[model samples]
Target: MDLQIIQNRIIEIRGQRVMLDFHLAELYEVETKVLKQAVRRNIERFPEDFMFELTKSELDKLRSQTVTFDWKPTTYAPFVFTEQGVAMLSSVLKSKKAIRVNVEIIRAFVQLRKLAIQNSEIIHRIDEMEKKYDKQFKEVFTALRYLIHPPEKERRRIGYKK
Candidate 1:
């Protein structure tokens, strides 16, 4: 599977990056219900940080804000699994397909982390350059503008010296 495909499924929720169970089920080629059942059977493996159920309102918010969410209305709030939770799934789901998909999913998560770090470093460098150049450029431009159109002479004090 393309890492980009997996990455696109990842979403930031509750201040952590997570993948919804349905998306993972689709990736694993299993029904969403079966996946949920497996997770419930291995609930101990998943802590609060590893997995959590969204509130009804939270799901609604996602549906409204993101075009990717085309979830039909359902009685149960869908569970979201974090990176660790996805890794833990490989153990519970012993099928070869599950294992393979899990590996790809883990890779996708790692790639995203790497990307975020790179972007942050890039932004920091950009900020440093801006700070270093802002004043110098301002002075240079001021000088150039002065030469191009020198400030108007003081108009002889407009007929009176205060």
Candidate 2:
């Protein structure tokens, strides 16, 4: 039920934050096969927008870019659950731990949103500062270039070199 544990379950793949099926299974205290079976049995509950399987290329990209524990090319593609699908998981996975973990996961999603918004603001400020100082920086660069590399007319003769 720890938020940190749920937050750690989130991963960035395909340029979006998502939870992989195996990680969700572990969090819900179910075997990966069991969780996949439940999802398969209740496919209607998960629409394409709510849940989708990662393509082989997408999976490969994730594997290449991200560090993982005990990861292998899965026989079946991993399912990615969006916010709505995460909520639906509670209904499909009925257990005390599931309920508790689901709540933590929801909170983690909200925290992620807040963090993203905060990061956007920070990036915006950085962009503004960069824009404001760009002219000054260019002038400084020009001045430094002149100091470091003088004109051919200003070159001094090397007395020792033949």
Candidate 3:
């Protein structure tokens, strides 16, 4: 599977990087219901930290913000699996495809973590540079910060003049 496709399926929820049941099912080449049944049968393997059901509000927010073209709002809340939960799934699933998909998913998660670490290092180096430089470089650092983390929305026109 393409790493970018896997990475796109992984999302942040409640500050945790997770894959929803539907996505995992698609990757495992099983019906979502079948996957949920497997997880239910081996519920003990999943603790709160490993997996959790998305709350209605969380699901709504996710639907509103993300490309959930394949997913329609359903009465049942989706289950989200963290990295640990995904690792456990390989044992529960016990299929060659499941194992292979799990490996790819795990690699995607690892790549995301590595990127996060690299970004932090870059930010730290930028901070050190700012400290060494004077106020003259403040705008440069500000521009970098904006590039790294852009504002959610454009700022309103200040003191508007025709």
Best by TM-score: 3
Residues 28-130 of candidate 3 have per-residue lDDT tens digits of 9998889999999999999999999998889889887786548765678999999999999999999999999999999999999999999999999999999
Sort order, TM-score high to low: 3, 1, 2
TM-score-better candidate, 1 vs 3: 3
Candidate 2 on 22-127: residue-level lDDT in tens? 8899888898889989999999999987789999898878776567545855689889988778889999988888888888899999999998899778667655
Candidates in order have lDDT scores of 0.87, 0.82, 0.93
Q: Candidate 1 vs candidate 2: which has greater lDDT?
A: 1
Rank list by lDDT: 3, 1, 2
Best by lDDT: 3
Estimate the overall C-alpha local distance difference test score of candidate 2.
0.82
Candidate 1 is scored at a TM of 0.81
Count clashing pairs, candidate 1: 0
lDDT of 3: 0.93
